[model samples]
Target chain A: MALWKNGAFVDDAWREIAEGEDPPPAGHVILPLDWWEQERDAFEGSNAPLGLRVAPGVPIERFARDINRFALIELVFPKFGDGRAFSMARLLRERHGFRGELRATGDVLIDQIQMMARCGFDTFQISDATTERLLRERGAPAYKRFYQPGATPEAPVDSRPWARRPG
Target chain B: MYRYDEFDAAFVADRVSAFRDQVSRRLSGDMTEEQFRPHRLMNGLYLQLHAYMLRVAVPYGTLNARQMHKLAHIARVYDKGFGHFTTRQNIQYNWPALSDVPAILDELASVEMHAIQTSGNCIRNVTADHFAGAAADEIEDPRPYAEILRQWSSIHPEFTFLPRKFKIAVNGADWDRAAIQVHDIGYQIVRNEAGEVGFAVYVGGGLGRTPMIARKLRDFLPKADLLAYTQAIVRVYNLEGRRDNKYKARIKILVHEKGVDPMREAVEAEFAAASREFISLPASEIARIKSYFAPPALQARAACDAYEARRQTDPRFAAFAANNVHPHRVAGHGVVTISLKPIGGVPGDATAAQMDAVADLAARYGHDEIRVSHEQNLVLPHVALDDLPAIYDELAANGLATANAGLISDIIACPGLDYCALATARSIPIAQRISERFGEGERARDIGELKIKISGCINACGHHHVGHIGILGLERKGVETYQITLGGSGDETCSLGTLTGPGFSSEEVVDAIERIVNVYMSVRTDRSEDFLAAYRRVGMQPFKEALYETSKGADI
Candidate 1:
């Protein structure tokens, strides 16, 4: 899978382990919520970068205490229309102050990339070539002006406390 | 009306371009219909029974002459010869091709209009009292705040994919013309003891398969915190509201499942958090928005004697003046309601010719301002009394003058099975039949202010739950039947209508309505007592007996 990080498509260095699979002696690995829960201590002290993959049903609050310890956090969209992950990403960034690579995976579409970016998703795992091409060519077809203040640092801030920093 | 600034203009232009791209993708077979459906819906495009319907937002029900003319032009050029104004104060075209939708949206964008956030699960139009700035009873015009909310909610990243659609209404007058009580979020502009204006916030009130009266979430919320508080409410609903069942997906269901106290506490916590980080509205920004809504510089003039003379001399003019004219804050000017609900006509459909004429009238005599009431009537917010005769003549000439503003014939009906794909039975025909029965002007004037609302199904888009006389149409054993409800209201004292006995067939429903009205007419304390007042004083017992006594052969 190609990961679009920063701006360009990059090689996905982290290997995601399935629910029943055994973890490889890892350089960079993503673990499911159950695996992370069971083997928390073993990976916490590891020298390699660690990431956690969370589904929609798994509460993000469960990882609140250990949120900052991970180098990357992957949020699953499950389907194109289900947007629960967007809120989860915002909570991780703004609420928990997790300053790490927030990656979006599974069913990530070009149309939703701008919104995901606003909600603090820095990397996207997209399989569709068209979406990847669009991301590379034009970069998230966002309306330059925004109404609500999100986790994006590019948001405009004005004198109004509610207003985002002026772009 | 809030004028679009550079930011607002660019925002809308971008939205149109994005929608165009999506449409092109769908046309090119790059995206499936399922993938494109929500995108179209988010832009207010719907595939109805016959053709695609596009609902355009009329923010706070306020529009200017140019906008109205553009709407008329769109009707004449694009769709059929007319458009239907809905109970939400938006206009819907019954016919448009999917391929032509992007062009239509581009046309709308040129006129400082768009269909963004009009449909879908996110926040819909933020409706307010139609007579907001002009009303004498208003403490403060609520449209400015409504506009603020509109801007905040439009393309909100977190709320785009909500479990169910959400509606918000604001009212500043003593009377609830906006029907704030039955919306997802209701804001009543009020002044506290300290003499500062704020909002009395109501949460979870909605009408659908399950009707509910919203409970007060906050007795008073400061004006500065409106956006933060609203965001908090929607966030809580987004995270906790039932998504497994679409029927139970509204915030109302969440509020119902969790008691009011718990819901309020959760909202309060979220509000506190949002205040800390996400949002804060400055006093200057609010003042800036408020300045746009400042009332027109209306000259103080005396009531003309010619108006009185014409009213006395012409009975038709007198009836029109008595029913159509409303009390304006300015002494010499009046708020004139141009009835869209002509007898035997579709309640809210207005032809292109009529629209152009109304737009002309607004430009000439009404300060170029017009409003669409939630009851499906148009209002000239500032018509001088001296100019009434000329305006009336022009309206009458164009078949636009109908002297039934709040009278019995002024019915609210949804575009039912005939036009709506979701409707199980027809509501427009029922409204037409009732309007024809009560077609007489003098007879309607005698009946006084009686609201009869009809819905095709329990969705209550027609707002049947809050009408004084509510009719709910349903299909029973392959036959169209209607159940009657009485005493429901959408005012300050909002109440859901109580269902009357058994259902009635289409043929028998009109007779049933007449019988109920007859009972109210006979037993009312005086001619001044409206159907609602009498129904309230005497309760539903008398009306129930009058409806079912003959069929059952016994009175309980």
Candidate 2:
């Protein structure tokens, strides 16, 4: 329930996978998506990693190895009160090596897109907003090769596009 | 005085612009008080007892005439008619508005001055001997190292938010004037047998609620490792110092809790990793910085028959000359400390007019060097001996010739409760009363070499813990009370003062201090055995008895 999905809370009620078998959401561990708050066993089983995200403090202490065990870290902005989330995503991409789809979910105003992109958040999902096109324009200028301190050195400029994005 | 070179000017300008942007953002609601607090404080704006107080770093307590004028202008433009000089040798304007701070910073930047690192948990202003270059007993001047430290610690990324506020002081004098041991890190410059300059580094020394004298970490640190070694100490402090308990968070506590050996070993390990790094001061760089502090030109002169004749007739001049002035290393020159404690005036305070007058005197009579001493007095370091009579005349005319340098009247007191929010009790009033009480005595010389330091709280900004007779202002049951401590010394071997018995009311504190001094005079073998020396020989019992004579209740 902590993870917002499809513009609302993704109901965590478990659904039966097979007859006489356990539920779907039942075994899915819940996490706040903040880097520090994400638990170790959230994705312990043969399943996709639960998101881990949040803002980082000054001088960003958390490194790539710190979050490397996890498969994905999604930066969550609870409210505009937090700034550590932007820095967290930046550190995750450039420093901590979090390369999975970096998503921005909460408190996603149209204003913070460029800086967020510069810091390495690729995809931003606003919870509810009428002007999606305007927001897209704001998010239009995502990247022209990253200049952040901890970015992957070998990107489109160094590696061919086919090799760079395996997906 | 170090001129504003292009580099210095550019850095100050950048800081000013940054502060201006910060102010604009704060005004536009882009930053909250929590976010803006550190930024504002780093730029020297403090939300104090009433308003924002801006403390301008007077590096090594040296200021040129132009800078003094700028300070005076700051007083006129942004504040009341006066600015208060702090115990740390910086000047603070108590009434600058939050809006004008950026503009005030711009004005300061015009003169190669900025309030960067004046506050916050970073290394505060690096102070050195006020008489760094011109003192009689001199090694290499410590100001270059101080300046280097100033540059390195200015907005330093690693050690900005440490366990607590850090202070560093360097001293080259045999007689410690800068209160070196009371700093977080104190370095004394020394030349080894090979005639190469190095430092005797002391760490974990500071004054707070739990006052402690620093301990030596290394016997000798090569001059090259000055910056790296400093960084190492700070890095070790940042990594290991406790942040849970604010009071027990200074480097002194870490050194105390872990013991000096373990803490020192930790620092050395970090230092070994940081050793021979790019931050090391190159020989050429050292000499280049040293060149900025070269001694001013001195012209030869004969011993003054003019001053001799003036002294023959004027007993006042004779007293001022004999007791107040210090001998200079240069021939036919004397270093004069112009007392700001003019009976009722606040210590270390100069009205705008008074500041202009001092600036005028420095330009006309003395060399272009002026020193703001730790005792809250100003020193004209090099005045020709022949000009002594004229200098005394000018000083007397300006009401600065208070013929009391180390006398009981020369009491050192901080801004206390009046101006500083951190103060527990008022210090200025007590200082004024003490100066007034001792003002009537014709026997000023009898109260020889006494140091009465009072701090409002245990922060020891006034350095009360280091005084020969220390008065600490503490609040008792909603009453402003002062506790008396004895035998506190701030020289090369610094020691924290021990409080004797209970506290006294503000009204009775002056009389108690007098009684303590009277007891010293009565028991001393001779006048040469000053209060400190006498107290060293015969401990605090006599002084305690003297304080207990009139009041029967304090369990003497």
Candidate 3:
């Protein structure tokens, strides 16, 4: 998966471990929620960086207590229209105070990336070839001015609920 | 009316350019129709039965003469010389090519208007009382708060793709003219013992296949917590609303299944959490918006001799004054409703010529202000009583002097099978027929105030659930059928209309309505008791027996 961070694409270093796959003893690894739940004891003493993949319906409170242990939490949008993950991302960042990297995965379209970022997703896993091509061709369509506060600071800050003046 | 600031202007221009690119991509085959549907809908472009329909937002039903003239220009150029005003106080053009939409949006942006969020599963236009600033009974104008909401909900990041469309209405008068009770969230401006202003928040109300009235979520919420509380409610709904079933995805279903108490508890907890983070509305910004909607300065003048003379000499003028004019808060000024529903005409369809005439009159007599009511009528909110005669003459010349504001001929009907892809039966003809039946002479006037609302299908876009006399059009086995519901109202004393009986054929529906009216006339205590009050007092037994039993005997 091509990981988009800040404004450009970068190599994704983390390996996503599927449910029945064995984990490598090195590098950053992301595990499926169910598998991590069942084998959490094996990683209790390991020094490896960990990440968790959460589906839309999994209540954040279920694993909010263990949020501090993971460096990344990847939220999945089952479909482009399925927006339950947006609310979850906000709750994780603002409510649970999870300051780690929030990644958006599955059905990540160019149109949804701006909103996902506003809702606190810092990285997006782009799989759609069209979206990737559009990103390269047009870059991200940023308005810079917004009516509501977001997780990311709008440039020329403190001009919220209004337009930001250019320096 | 609120004017766009630099922020609003720049944002709209940016959106138009982005949509221009999106449209070009769709045309170039880079985007599939399925992928492009939601994007187009967000900009208020709908693929209707005939062609693309563009719905432009008239924020809180408030616009100036300049904006009205621009709408007229669009209708004359881009559409078939007309536009349809919707129940949510927006205007829709029936025919526009997909390729020309970007240009149309660009034109709209020049007027500080765009169709953003008018459709789709995002927060729709924030509607307010038509007589907000001018109503005699208003506690405070609701348009300022509505403007705040309009800005906040524009391209709302998390809410642009919700389970279902959300609607919010605000009412500030003693009488609920805005129909607040039927929206997803309703705000009623109120004051406490110390005379401090706030809001009474109502949540989860909607009209669709499943119609439900919003329940009171809070008796009073401080003015400062408006956005914070609204964010909380929407967040809770976004997280918990059902996505498994499209029909059951509205916030109303979630509120119903979980109950209002649990919904309130969850929203309050979320509000507490959300308030600490963001959504803190600054008082200076609120005051800034409030200043934009301040009442126009008018010097009191003596009553017009011409107006009085016209009322005495011309019966039509008298009728217009009696039915079409509302009391204004400012002395010597009256609010005039220019009816779009003429006898034997399509409800809410306005010709470009007529729109121009209204715009001209608004600039000449009104405070350069115009308003579109949810009832599908244009309003001159701050018209001086002295200029009534001149305004009436212009209106009469333009075929806009319908003199049927709340009367029977003033109907609310959706563009049914004639235009809408979702409609099963035609609604415009039904409305035209009903208006013709009751159009002539004093029949409608004698019948007193009656609201006849017709919807093409059960989706209730026409608000059939709350009409005093509701008509739902359906198709059963290749035949057009209409079901009638009685006693529904959208006022402060809000109630859902109950089904009268079995459905009627297209030919029989208007007759069915007349028979019901006949029953109402006979049983009513006096003409003062309208159809709804009579139905509530006498119950449905009388109307039902007259409709079905008499039909059975005649057929037999």
**Which one wins on DockQ?**
3
Please write out the lDDT profile of model 1 over residues B402-465, one tens digit for every residue: 9999988899999999999988789999999999998748788999999999999988899999
What lDDT score is found at residue B303 in candidate 2? Answer: 67
How far out, in Å, is residue B496 in model 2? 1.7
Better of 2 and 3 by DockQ: 3
Chain A TM-scores, all candidates? Answer: 0.86, 0.51, 0.90
Model 1: residues with Cα > 4 Å off, grouped in runs: A25-27, A127-139, A155-167, B275-278, B550-556
lDDT of 2 at B440: 22
lDDT of 2: 0.73
State which candidate, 2 or 3, has the greater TM-score. 3
User: What lDDT does each candidate get?
Assistant: 0.88, 0.73, 0.89
lDDT of 3 by residue, A38-157 (tens): 988888788778899999978888898889988899999988888989999989998889998899999999988989998899999998888888788876667767777777776433
DockQ of each: 0.58, 0.06, 0.63
Q: What TM-score, computed on C-alpha atoms, does each candidate reach?
A: 0.96, 0.80, 0.97
Tens digit of per-residue lDDT, candidate 2, span A58-96: 233443444654444456666532344654564456445
After TM-score superposition, what is the CA distance of residue B413 in candidate 2 from its true location, in Å? 1.0
- Compared with the true structure, model 1 gives a TM-score of 0.96
Q: What TM-score does structure 2 among the candidates reach?
A: 0.80
Candidate topping lDDT: 3
